[model samples]
Target: MNRRRTSRSASAEELLSTLQHLTARAREEVGLHQARVELAQALQRKMLPADLPAFPGVRTAARYAPARDGLDIGGDWYDGFLLPDGALGLAIGDVQGHDVEAAAFMGQIRIAMRAVASTVADPGEVLSRTNDLILSMDSSLFATCSFFRFDPVTRELSGARAGHVAGVWATSDGRSGITSDAGGLPLGIQSGQSYPVTRRTLDVDGAFVLLTDGVIEGPSLSIGDGLEEVRRLVSAHAGASAEELADRVLRAAGLTGHEDDAAVLVLRNEIPSREAASPDGG
Candidate 1:
């Protein structure tokens, strides 16, 4: 009996030792995973635009949020800059993934789109060229994007979609709707895809919004409902500043606990009031 008790005690000690070893290993793995997540988050932040360009008569705001439930990062991105001809160029896209590769691909696509937009003024052509560039690459990844060139002076806004979510627009008089423009396949799918362009004039005080699908779709929510919710919010708060509008959209989308990354860009056409535009106060 004494020998049997001693054997059982030894076995218990061995089991405890193994459990300790496994616990330590798990902690190390968790630490490494956390470090990787931080690194990927930093890379994603670096890839995105640090600031949305500021232009007279136009107010722009952008927001990016990572998935709330994972260590991996996603590829939702947005960009705004001034074109050579004084038009405001805006873009939002999502690469197909939730890892470091997706983030890197997003950076490459953003750079390519900017380079193409610099020489190509047509929104449709810009997307086509970008598609060509992606197809030329050695990657098998695909991306969806919405590109727009807004001429503040003429109130003309031309946009093209590449399997991306359609943008929403609100007129100064409180009319709002989702864009109905036709779109082509996502980039990297085919070499000769053509993205159709949709052009409209944004009246003074009007606003346009672009966002990734993650903003509208989730585990329990359908995209259609999400879009209608966003449209209602925009219409109800059409007079809010661009920044406030962006924040409201994210908050309403429950981004704090969302499972996918999301991005949003808001552009508001603001003409100075007669009193402010007048010299010597009229």
Candidate 2:
């Protein structure tokens, strides 16, 4: 009986030891995953602009958030800057995947777009040149991109998109919807592809919302459903300022448990007074 008790005691000890080892291993794996997420988030933040460019009669805001649990590097980016021709240049894009290669490709495409836009004024030409550059990169990566150049003085906003969602414009006057022709073949798919420039006039106190798909999509939601949700959110918060509107959209998206990263850019055409919206106040 003494020998039997000894053997059972040794077996119990071994079982406890095995359980402790497994628990420690799990903790280690979690720590490693957390470290990678932090690193990826840091890299994403560094690549995307922290704040939108501001000028007289023009207000802009952007939000970029990387998911907290992913082994892949975030491949979403948004950029807003003043072009050399005095137009506000805005860009948002999503690379094909979320790996490090995708992130690197995003950066290169962004830089190339900015450089090309600075020299070319038309949105189609800018996108056409950007697509050419991507094809030349010799990678299998593709991206959905949108670019808009807004002339605050003229209130004319012109831009082109390549397989991206439409830019949403909302106003206090109940005029709101997605821009027309908001998509094309994804960049890097075909060289010499033409991206048509869609032009629209933004009356004062109006807003334009541009974002990557992650801003609206969900695990169970279809793209159409996600996009409608965005339009609804924008309409629901139509009266807010540019900065406030950006925050409201994000809060409304409720992306806490979102599987992918999201980036949003909001642009508002502002004026000193309502009469400034037109050449004559009559």
Candidate 3:
């Protein structure tokens, strides 16, 4: 009996040792995963623009929110810049994933679009060329995008869509509606897909808004309802600054608990007030 008891004690010690070893390995794996996530997040932030370009009579602002339920990063991105011909170029897109690979692809797409838009004046041509470039890449990922060119002098807002959600616009007189732009397939789907351009004019004090589907779609909320909510918000807050309106859109969508990533871009045409433009307050 004494020999049997000693043998049992030895077996129990061996089992405890194995359990401790497994526990330490698991902790190490978790720490490694966390470090990787932090690094990816930093890299993703660096790819996006620090500030949107603003020009006379047009103010721009954007907001980006990452997925709340995952360790992986998302592909949603937005950009605004000046083209060679002096028009303001605005773009928003979503790559087809939520991983480190997706973030890297997002950066590549953004850069390619910028390079093409710098020389191409037409939004459709810009997307078409970018589509070809994406097809030439080694990855099989696809992306949806909306590209716009706004002429501040003429107030003409023209754009093209590539399987992207339509933008929303609100006029100074409270008229608001969703855009009806025709679109082609998402980029990288085919070799020669052509995006069509849609054109509209922005009334003074009007605003145009762009966003990714993550801002609207949720488990219980339908996309239609979400879009309607955004439309109403834009109409109601027509007087708000572009910055404030962008924030209100996110807060109204209850973005804190959203499962997917979200991004919003607001471009408002603000004519200088006579009093402000004048030397004296008249």
Candidate 4:
């Protein structure tokens, strides 16, 4: 009987020890993940523009949301900057995966994309250059991105997509459409694949909605349902300011429990009535 008791005690001790070791390891992993998330968030915040450019004839608003709950920052981002010819560069991209490494890679790709965008005159060329840069990087990672150069004065929005999510364009007449093409593979997947450049002339007071796949890839809903919800929200809030529209879209996405990193960029036409608004003679 004494031997049996001893054996049981030894077995319990061994099990306890193993449990403690596993607990410790898990704690360490959690800490490491937290650190990685912090680092990634900092890098992403730094890469994205703190303030939208003060350009004439256009109003812009951007919003980014991490997952509902977690320390994992995803690779979803947006960028807005002024081009040489008084045009506004509006872009949104999602690196193929979500995590610290993806976010870091996104930062690098973003800078390279901006540089390529600056040198290229057309928005399509900008995306082509950006895609090349992504393909040249380490072959393991992939990403999806979209690029656009919007001329507020002319109401022309020209852009391209590299396997990114479809874009939303809500026209002044209350009709809405999606801009998605089939050819371009996700950036970083293959070399020499090209994204077709598409252009749309904005009607009076038009708006564009750009987002990450995360917006549609939530746990509680399908992509089509999420999109329809977004469409409803945007339609309800159509006349609101750019910032308000962004807030509304993000709020709707969040309320729906989107479990992935998400971002939205709302570009609206706020053209001036008089020609004097554009000093550069556009």
Candidate 5:
């Protein structure tokens, strides 16, 4: 009886020690994961544009959200910048994965596209050049991107979509819905792919919503349904500020419990009050 009791006590002590060790290891892993997330977020911030270029005739706002259930996040990004020719450029894209490499590839694509866009001027040419750049990188990954250049002076919108979901376009006091167009293949899939360009006039006080697939994708809802939801949201809030509209769109997407990282760019054609004075000159 005495020997059995001693044996049982020894086994309990060993088990307790093992449990304590596991608990400590688990805590360390959690801390390490959190640190990784912070680092990844910092890298993402650096990769994305810190400020949207201040163009007088266009109001632009962007938003980015990491995956809710990810450790390092994914390669979803948005950017808006003023081109040398005074065109307001806006872009959003998603690389083909959820890893550091995806994010790195995203950065490469963005830089290449920006350079190509400012110089090329044509939206289709920009994506075509960017596609060539991606093909040259020898990466197995691919990306879906959309590019838009607004000629505020002419109230013209030129866009090129590369196998990405359709985006929403609206006039403040007029009709609003997803614009239809022919988009080419996604980037990195082929060496000499060409994206078709779509042109439209914003008329006045118009807005465009450019986003990644994650924005209109969820488990329970079909992509079509999600798009309709976005359409409703945009139409309902046509007169809101760009910043507010961006937040609201993101909030609406959040309610869908999107598992992928999401990025949104909202561009409005309203001229700033200050720019109103300068008009065409500004």
Candidate 6:
């Protein structure tokens, strides 16, 4: 009886020890993962712009959504700046992978694109330069980007796309139009590939919403479904400011089970009549 009791006690002790060890290992893994996620978030914030520039003649608003759990920050990014010709430069791009490396590459490409645009007024030329730069980068990396130059004075918008997801342009009356082509290759994939530049005139009261694949690619929603959701939301709140539009759209999308970082920027052309404001640039 004494021997049996001793054996039972030993077995219990061994099981307890194994459980403690396993618990410690699991905690270590969780800590490591948390550290990695924090590092990635920090890096992403550092690489992307915290605020866009204010142009004298443009009304712009932007939104960026990192994954809900602080997962990897994808290449979904937007750029807004003033061109030399007093037009607004709008850009959105997605680097191929949703990892730290892709985010870093996106940073480099975005900076290069801004540099190119500063010197080149043509939207197509700026994207072509970006494509060339990306091709010289790592052969395994690829990116899709769209660039647009909007002249508020003329209401003319010139755009170029390098295989990015299409953007939606909505009128104040709930009508929407898709504004991208489907043939251009992503940057870093080919050296000589050229992105086609598309030009159109925005109605004095129209707004454009540009987004990344993360916004549409989810297990629960198809691209068409996502687009319709966006359309309905924008149409319902067509009179709201760009910033308001962005916030409402994000809320509508919700954060439940979202596996990818999402971002969007809304550009609205609200050119008040000459009688609406002072001539000294209000």
Model 6 stretches with alpha carbons more than 4 Å out: 69-72, 180-183, 255-257, 275-282
Off by over 4 Å in 2: 1-24, 68-73, 255-257, 274-282
Q: Which stretches of candidate 5 lie over 4 Å from their true place?
A: 69-72, 271-282
Highest-scoring model, TM-score: 1
* Whole-structure CA lDDT of model 4: 0.78
Query: Candidate 2: worst 10 consecutive residues by lDDT?
Result: 65-74
lDDT of each: 0.87, 0.80, 0.87, 0.78, 0.85, 0.77
lDDT of 5 at 109: 94
Q: What stretches of model 4 exceed 4 Å from their correct place?
A: 1-18, 180-183, 274-282
TM-score of every model? 0.93, 0.84, 0.92, 0.86, 0.91, 0.87
What CA RMSD would you report for each candidate?
A: 2.5, 3.4, 2.9, 4.0, 3.6, 3.5
Please tell me which model should have the higher lDDT, number 5 or number 6.
5
Better candidate number, 1 or 4, judged by lDDT: 1
RMSD in angstroms, candidate 5? 3.6
Q: Rank the candidates by lDDT, best first.
A: 1, 3, 5, 2, 4, 6
Residue 132 miss distance in model 2 (angstroms): 2.7
Displacement of the residue 275 alpha carbon in candidate 2, Å: 7.3
lDDT (Cα, tens digit) per residue for candidate 4, span 1-282: 999999999999999999999999999999988887888788778878888875565789999987645556888889998887778888888876667788888888888888887788686678777778867776577878888888767778888888887877665567766666543777787677767788878756667888887776577877777777777677666667889988888777765567788899998776557675688977
lDDT of 5 by residue, 44-135 (tens): 87999988875666788988888875555888989898889888888999998877778888999999998898789999999999999879
Residue pairs that clash (backbone atoms under 3 angstroms), model 3: none
Candidate 6, residues 2-40, lDDT tens digits: the string is 999999999999999999999999999999887877766
- Pick the winner on TM-score between candidates 1 and 2: 1
TM-score of 6: 0.87
Better of 1 and 6 by TM-score: 1
* Candidate 2 residue pairs in backbone clash: 163-184
